[model samples]
Target: MLERRGVMVSGAAAVCFYEVCPTVDQYCQLRLIAGLSEKAKEAAEMALPKTVFAVSGYHCCDLVAMGRIVGDGACHLQLCDIAVHPRLQRQGLGREVVLRLTAWLDKNLPPSAEVSLIAKGASNLLYAQYGFVPTAPAAISMCRRC
Candidate 1:
């Protein structure tokens, strides 16, 4: 695993045990706590089931961070909904979440599988650390929201 800040995680992130996927309620709540906007509960319900792989970090029996890999696992995949609770920020939990999802992709997906994520602001730096780079000048990222 890639170390965070040249140091192995030894705090909440290190202690948290990750599940392959969290319950829908857990997924939504984690996102909300991270200051992400809330969506209809039904939307969350539908989305959670579609994830190809997900990782939820738990510390002291409470869910503290989360991320999900969605899209076609074989040919293309997108990482989304990565968040760590405000109280849990800076504990490496966010990195741990990404690490888990990427590790799963590396092990399970074929080499031909293409992975991408739309990272905003400073989060780009974090994603870059995991080998995600800008496709700028080649391909641009575009999105449509409902």
Candidate 2:
């Protein structure tokens, strides 16, 4: 069993999962969550190359879910691009995905490793419940494409 944020998860398994396509459908769902344009071709081009996606196929048995963790293995990790289909929302699947990913990180990343993520809307509260704190007072965040 895995526990986080007053939730318990079991009976699910995640392998050494990786996906290159991750489906345009799934991509569009995640883009909606992030408040990005679901019709933006540039967003699709930008997201496809950077995502390392995982999905669940146990209960509802579909590729209607996804998440990603991108970073150097030793010191930094960023959890991003998490999305469950609209029909599956509020069914505890998102928490399950985050739990599995953090479990993977705990086992694989170094002891002092720091994981970062850009949470969408109230999702920041979800991540905070998993021990993610604001990177404030010490440093601010910035991004650029190059």
Candidate 3:
């Protein structure tokens, strides 16, 4: 089990326990329920152990939110799999997870490290508050399913 790092109380008075990294099963289930793209268990197994930093939030014993940073420790880092359960959306759980992840990055990353994340839909709005901006003319994000 991931150890508890902190506790949060949502606006609706829901108490949530936060921890560093979730188990593979919790990671898969939370992403599905939170509407992120599905990732295969094998992929998750290969990936989770490579995470540089991660945060998972649970309401009681149920996982409700998560975020992770992946990359080589020095040069490249990307924020991925940020999610919050629909029932708990707008309660700041997502923001809290991002906040914790960024705080960790601030302390741990080298000065030259480039951190990035692909924001989908209006999620760029949420990420914007934390200093992310459109790469635009200089660069545009593009991807294809594997």
Candidate 4:
């Protein structure tokens, strides 16, 4: 079952509706407007359904922010696709998305499960507030395009 809530974005004076998942079209458009990597429709359709948990903020039906977790349900989980529209950045919607995702994780994850995300740019700072730490020296994040 998908959860829904409404919040007023500071400074925008608009009520943003938050829901558990975004439609494939909304997901792709949000990624593009938020300066995240582009995702093909087929790829997004394949990916969104696999989310372990997801949160999307929409203002009057337009996707403004989103975050999602994807991984095996028990052992390893990765937070990915965090994005906020440029106009909505710093308005607390991104934080709200993360907060919702993490809250879900807290309730669902087993004690031994590992949660991880590849933070980009200054996003690590925001994520750090939620108990994420830099895994440098002892561990490094490595990725390559398929």
Best candidate, lDDT:
3
Reference-based lDDT, each prediction? 0.78, 0.60, 0.86, 0.84
Model 1 scores a C-alpha lDDT of 0.78
Identify the leading candidate in terms of TM-score.
4
Clashing pairs in 1: none
Can you write out model 1's per-residue Cα lDDT over 98-131, one digit (the tens) per residue?
8878888889999889999988879998999898
Mind sharing the TM-score for model 1?
0.86
Lowest summed lDDT over 10 consecutive residues: which window, candidate 2? Answer: 1-10
**Evaluation by lDDT, superior candidate among 2 and 3:** 3
The global Cα lDDT (0 to 1) of model 4 is: 0.84
What TM-scores do the predictions have?
0.86, 0.65, 0.92, 0.93
- Per-residue lDDT of 37 in model 3: 89
43-117, model 2: which lDDT tens digit per residue?
666766664434332223234445777776567778876776565566666776777677777777778988888
RMSD of 1: 4.8
- Summed over model 4, clashes come to 0
Model 1 per-residue lDDT at 107: 92
| CA lDDT, candidate 1, residue 82 | 91
Better of 1 and 2 by lDDT: 1
